[model samples]
Target: MNKMHDFEASLQVLRGSETDITSEVNVIKTAVASANKRTAIRFQELNQKKFRMPLILGIGLLVLQQLSGINAILFYAGSIFKTAGLTNSNLAACGVGAIALLATGVTTWLLDRAGRRILLIVTSSSL
Candidate 1:
């Protein structure tokens, strides 16, 4: 057998299994080769027509998020609360900070489960 088959056979022996793993090894090899080839061709693939829409949308969303004044609002939240006539403006600012922290924690948990697109849509719509 070839090197890959030899490796697979050795692994099977180490695992103390008599069942054949040739098909599994071939599948894994095929997937690895495809991944390597894709990496080599990635830049050329990026210039294709099919990739334009997603690229434009991704960049546009990032630019819009930066331009939305969210950072300024967060940074100056205490001043904003004071200006808005809150008697305990510091407390209000702290509340805002706490909420932001909680939201970040929730987002971290939900990101893998709900995915990027869903999270982006929910956040954008809420804002």
Candidate 2:
């Protein structure tokens, strides 16, 4: 209740409120319970036989993505550039960062336009 009062105080700074904060908190609690129930239903549905393949594929792909050396390159970008005889490794690292940002922008654009299946296929194939 003290935390809820603190939260209400924070919001009151931005907006005036005459209503009881406890009532608002009760409404939020009910909404959260409904959301949790829906999520549990979805999890039960996902456990069905029809969803098994997709669940496996999704988990497998996530594991594979971690196994990929993308993180290694990003983590040791300076050392990588140095090993490749680049005098200004920092510039190379910055170039890598810029390219990663551009790729993320392009992927975000393509995901809405081209859809997930195509993007996943293209990205996984490139990997």
Candidate 3:
């Protein structure tokens, strides 16, 4: 009985004498609409900014990374094969690199819809 009275008092404070249930519902809906509008405006502003420049920068970086021989061992793997007792380590390394690249692309495709936070967590832990 005491708890029931406390609950009724809290409900009265939530409703007040002037505010009704419909007004409370409208307030919640307005808050959601405001949030959505703010998000849409943010997206519009981003679209109005330098979006194509990011693509050009990305392509330029990829070209530089590929042509610059950043990973010399990967680019000239024949020397590694000669140093070791292996005969075709270069071709084997190339095949392994191709398989790893394919697997990474597939994982990236899956991560698009599976949420980035989970992938970030898993990938960081893997590192």
Candidate 4:
């Protein structure tokens, strides 16, 4: 895990037009494989004791994140821009994605720092 993180840190340094993508991607693939091995071993160890709760939560999050409506929002992002009162939806969708990304970051950051009630209030007020 530590080595994988270090590899990723180095990979980031190779970004931009000057970087060789094929080699970089190969390195990333190797890092990913290492990470997968570590994850499999960790899970196998945890299976001996108690891994149910966190595993269930992870699977639930995965299912929720990939639900039809979430995919619909991604597929119909252009429509969302128009629905949000933008004239040029193609361009507006990019802005919408940026805003959504920022909102996700902020919400995740506030999840523990701010209570659920206050978080809902802030989100609702923004909407």
**Sliding window of 10 residues with minimal summed lDDT for model 1:** 35-44
Q: What alpha-carbon RMSD in Å does predicted model 3 have with respect to the real structure?
A: 14.7
40-120 per-residue lDDT for model 4 (tens digits): 446456565467777775686577567536678877999888888988998877877889899899888889797777865
Residues 29-126 of candidate 3: C-alpha lDDT, one tens digit per residue: 57766876743445455454476676665677577667667488676566677687677877877876898799889898988878877875675455
In terms of TM-score, how similar is model 1 to the real structure? 0.49
Prediction 4 global C-alpha lDDT: 0.72
Q: How many backbone clashes does candidate 3 have?
A: 0
Model 1 Cα displacement at 33 (Å)?
23
- Candidate 1 residues lying further than 4 Å off, grouped into runs, are 1-58, 125-127
**Candidate 3: where is the Cα deviation over 4 Å?**
1-77
Best by TM-score: 2
Cα lDDT, all candidates: 0.83, 0.83, 0.67, 0.72
Report clash pairs, candidate 2.
none
Residue lDDT tens for model 2, 31-126: 866876744447668889999999999898988878897788899999999999999999999999999999899989988999999878887888
Mark the 10 consecutive residues where model 2 has the least summed lDDT: 12-21
Indicate the TM-score of model 2.
0.61
Candidate of highest lDDT: 1
Ranking by lDDT: 1, 2, 4, 3
Model 1 lDDT, residue 20, Cα: 77
- What is the lDDT, from 0 to 100, of the residue 123 in candidate 1? 75
Cα error, residue 71 of model 4, in Å, equals: 2.5
